[model samples]
Target: MQIKDRINAFINLGKFLSEIDTESNPILNKAEAENGWFTQDNINFALNSWAKALSEENIKQWLSNYNLETTAQRSKIVAIIMAGNVPLVGFHDFLSVLITGNKALVKLSSNDKTLLPYLANHLISIEPKFKNLIEFTEGRLQNFDAVIATGSNNTARYFDYYFGKYPNIIRKNRNSVAVLTGNETEDELTKLANDIFRYFGLGCRNVSKIYIPENYNFEAFFKAMFSWKEIINNNKYINNYDYNKAVYLMDSFPLLDNEFMLLKEDNGFSSPISVVFYEKYTSLESLKKNLKESELHIQCIVSKAGIPNEVPFGKAQNPELWDYADGVDTVDFLLKLP
Candidate 1:
């Protein structure tokens, strides 16, 4: 299929996604049945984000930013090993391989087995040409010329050892962080809460940790976070909160609790569900040095602190098409595939 046709197919798929209502949509019901983690709210959020990203104007603007005219027109089969952390987490990589005039051999994660295939069927129904361009595998992946895999640090090593022979983009564990100046408005902090609570903090783009000025008061932060107090109503989340809090208390670790989530002073980037890690920074310059030293572990930064390339507060989940994971350009990697 031609590039324009592929783009149009995705745009139509986005329109279809926008119309899905979990209460009434059979597709969504099937997906939820297949994976209990794929809650209705989370599935709808993923669809809305994808719809916005796949709009005609957005797609054109994103493609315009790249020079695809010189890309070699040969076709290659690109294997995609998707992560099931969040709904449709691997769709972007799937779209990239197909949009760049390559075939996709996708291996779906067991935790997320239903949604993407349903969308793929929709794409083929929109334009039958897609039938030849997309395929899913349940067994060993073979006959693929290149690969794109997403997993934890341990699984990434296996991908490196096996797929290292092929052109590949293998992503390991990474988490997002926010730098707070302790002067943000309640509105901004409210938005930051969305970044944290959305998807139940499973996405890499979720703000798992925050950096605040030393001696920062917790009153305003706790008040702003109260907007999401309803999250405790979720049984799964409450279980995590209860378990993690008990573990911290047993160890006599200092914690800030609001009955819904726990906050602890930790220097790490990845935080457990229903918990957020925080660190105190003395100066912006020193924080910059620390961030630079651990850039690889960070997926994105949410801040209004004038930090370079920092994603604005509350917009971490709404990544643009160019916001490649692990700072690796998937499109450029596909374009250069030999």
Candidate 2:
């Protein structure tokens, strides 16, 4: 099939995802609340967009180095080690392998075992060709020529030490941050909320901390995000807030609270729970220099100005098809493999 047709297939799958829900599914509801289910809404938004942009025409246009000079083409396998932190985190890896005509040997995350298989099943209904390419495994993951793995900073150390010996893309722990100029209006703050609540602030792409000018008032930000009070109202999410808040309060740490979680400012790389820590910046040039120094460590930067033209706040979540996590293009890399 053409790349455009493949994109349409993805869009069609998104529509299917938006409608299929088990009304009597206790398992489904529980997963949605805590584990970030592949909900119809989430699925539609994610899959539909991915599909439309990843059409063959677009893929071929971008994949200019595509040469049909490889041996045993269109039948290789790629093993995928998925992250369980959010719904369908591994789907991108799966898509890269499948679109390149390689079978996917998937090692599903225990935290998200059902969603991938269900999604694969849905894709099978959409195109039976995927049936030959997708399958679930507990431990039997041999026979793949390449692998894609994502894990914590600690686990990434292990993954690199091991998977480095093979044809693999091993991702370490990377966190995103926001840059505030102390001049943002309320609308910008509302849009900034997307950087936080997209996946309950689960993925590394989520904004863990932000940079604001000294003594910057946060009431406006809090007020802007008032509609998201439901994030704390969620039992699963609230439990995290309460547990973390209690630990902090017990340690004699002051908390600025409304109804959900505490807002704590600290000198760290990232924040925990529902709170987002901030730092004060005096100049844009300093922020840019710090970002350049920490480029490999910083995953995404949410900023209005005083940064590179390529990076934009709230635009991190709507990444195009070619934009891989940690900014590595898996398709480009795999296509270059000898």
**Number of the predicted model whose lDDT against the real structure is largest:** 1
Among these predicted structures, which one has the highest TM-score? 1
Candidate 1 residue lDDT tens string, 85-163:
9999999999998888889999999989888998899899999988988999999999999999999999999999999
lDDT for predicted candidate 2 compared with the true structure: 0.71
TM-score of 2: 0.86
- In model 1, the Cα lDDT at residue 90 comes to 99
**What TM-score, to 2 decimals, does candidate 1 have?**
0.97
What's the true lDDT of residue 277 in model 2? 73
Q: Which consecutive 10 residues in model 1 have the weakest lDDT in total?
A: 64-73
Model 2, residue 74: displacement in angstroms? 5.1
